[model samples]
Target: MSEANECLFCKIIAGEIPSNTVYEDDSTIAFSDIHPKAKVHVLIVPKKHYANVAELAEQDSHELSHMVGIAKSIADKEFHGAYRLIFNTGEDAGQSVFHVHAHVLTGEVMAE
Candidate 1:
């Protein structure tokens, strides 16, 4: 497994930082976003650190599927089975944190 020394998501996974965790397993965690862009916004991340989807693909493709599975489960319960799963790969794509995470958005129509 890979890890970063200064990654915020790493801290959260380590329990060094507090988060409103919704779901968790040995390999991944899902939590509510602090600054939500939609009514229901959750962040699903892997315990192992990866900078982005491309990095994650290089490291472990299974983890990507696992993260998405968790997101689908969350959406099924919270938003009655309707949601958007997003991955912002770079700053220009709106990715802020370096760690790879899936944004599960629902409960409102997002601007196009």
Candidate 2:
């Protein structure tokens, strides 16, 4: 199978895999993480697959910005507009799914 075909996030975006969708738009989708790291943890993903943040930035910066916007929107609704955004670019960085995504974390005091 192709990379996108094998990608878990791609499957979720395709509706082949079920997800607890929190938000969605023409170019993006936001869903609750299966293993949430925070009280409010959502993964904001682009509908089109990209390997990592660098690839997404190079190919579609608009989507990257849109993902951040979505994250902020989720935080505003779920918490009190205080949020942390993370993009794990590679295995060493903790990116497990291969598809580019932004982790929106909030609702509790994060260890600094």
Candidate 3:
């Protein structure tokens, strides 16, 4: 059920697709967004493919938190002013992209 083959993030992490990687470690990768919602927007993704939040139950807690921690670090580096972190889990939530990722947006509304 984990679409590892067709998953875009999997390709990105695997070096099949080119992404502007700003930060990377064994557990996570931070890259610039192809579509920017603010002055600074980046997608923080786990090295392993996860369809969405619902599928995250199979992932380790340490890796999950590490991804989030990397998100905060990237946001602080790029969007020094302020930022918002969001994740859309399913179709109803507007998750056109199934690769479990955190959207870090800055230069936008505080509540966004």
In order of appearance, the predictions have TM-scores of 0.90, 0.97, 0.85
Give residue 91's lDDT in candidate 2 (0 to 100).
100
- Our model 1 lands, by Cα RMSD against the true structure, at 2.3
What is candidate 1's CA lDDT for residue 51? 90
| Candidate 2 C-alpha lDDT tens digits along 43-85 | 9999998999999999999899888889888888878898999
Among these predictions, the greatest lDDT belongs to 2
Q: Which ten residues in a row have the lowest lDDT in candidate 2?
A: 71-80
Query: What clash count does candidate 3 reach?
Result: 0
Per-candidate alpha-carbon RMSD to the true structure? 2.3, 0.8, 2.3
Give the runs in model 2 whose Cα sits over 4 Å from its true position.
none
- Candidate 1 vs 3: which has more lDDT: 1
In model 1, where do residues sit more than 4 Å from their true spots? 1-3, 109-112
**Which tens-of-lDDT digit does each residue in 27-107 have in candidate 3?**
788888999887778888888777886676466667777877776776667667367878898999989879888888875
* Winner by lDDT between candidate 3 and candidate 2: 2
**Superior by TM-score: candidate 1 or candidate 3:** 1
> Can you rank all candidates by TM-score, best first?
2, 1, 3
> For all candidates, what are the clash counts?
0, 0, 0
- Give the per-residue Cα lDDT of candidate 2 at 15: 95
